[model samples]
Target: MVIKGGILLAIRYNSHRYTRDIDFSTNQMLGDINKDEIANRLNKSMAIMGESL
Candidate 1:
């Protein structure tokens, strides 16, 4: 996955831009993506951070 848009620019250059969203991309096709697995992983991560979706 690649991070794009304002979030990337802010992190890469330490810019002062304010961004409210994160953008991601993958080389895999949409049909090949596993939605449940992704959701599970994200849930686990959020749990580790004491948060939830």
Candidate 2:
């Protein structure tokens, strides 16, 4: 996934804007992927990083 929107702007440009959520872009189409599986994987990754969904 690629990060975008307010979060990206804040990091890249050092903007002071506050954002409550993250935005992402994927190369695969939504219809071609299992969202639940992806969510599980992402959650696991976050857990490994000491973060949570």
Candidate 3:
């Protein structure tokens, strides 16, 4: 999923309950970041953790 900017994902720091889907929080990226690329990266990262898309 596409993560919008100016949000915070609180689960990273303290241990919090999480949902099945990942919640993202990112500051606005000034440069170019392809959506497909992000999806691919996320998919690869999830694969490493034995998670499926």
Model 1 alpha-carbon miss at residue 43, Å: 6.7
Please provide, for model 2 over 14-51, each residue's C-alpha lDDT reduced to its tens digit, 9 standing for 90 to 100. 98884978888899988998989978987887688665
TM-score of each: 0.54, 0.58, 0.49
Clash counts per candidate, in order, are 0, 0, 0
Report how far residue 36 has shifted in candidate 3, in Å: 0.5
**lDDT digits (tens) for residues 1-53 of candidate 3:** 35432222433344354455555655657365587888899888768757531
Better of 2 and 3 by TM-score: 2
RMSD of each candidate relative to the true structure: 4.3, 3.7, 6.2
Per-residue lDDT for 1-53 in model 1, tens only? 67688977886898888497878899999899998998798688668757522
Worst 10 residues of 3 by lDDT: 4-13
lDDT of 1 at 30: 85
Name the better of 1 and 3 by TM-score: 1
**Model 1 per-residue lDDT at 13:** 94
**Cα deviation of 20 in candidate 2 (Å)?**
2.3
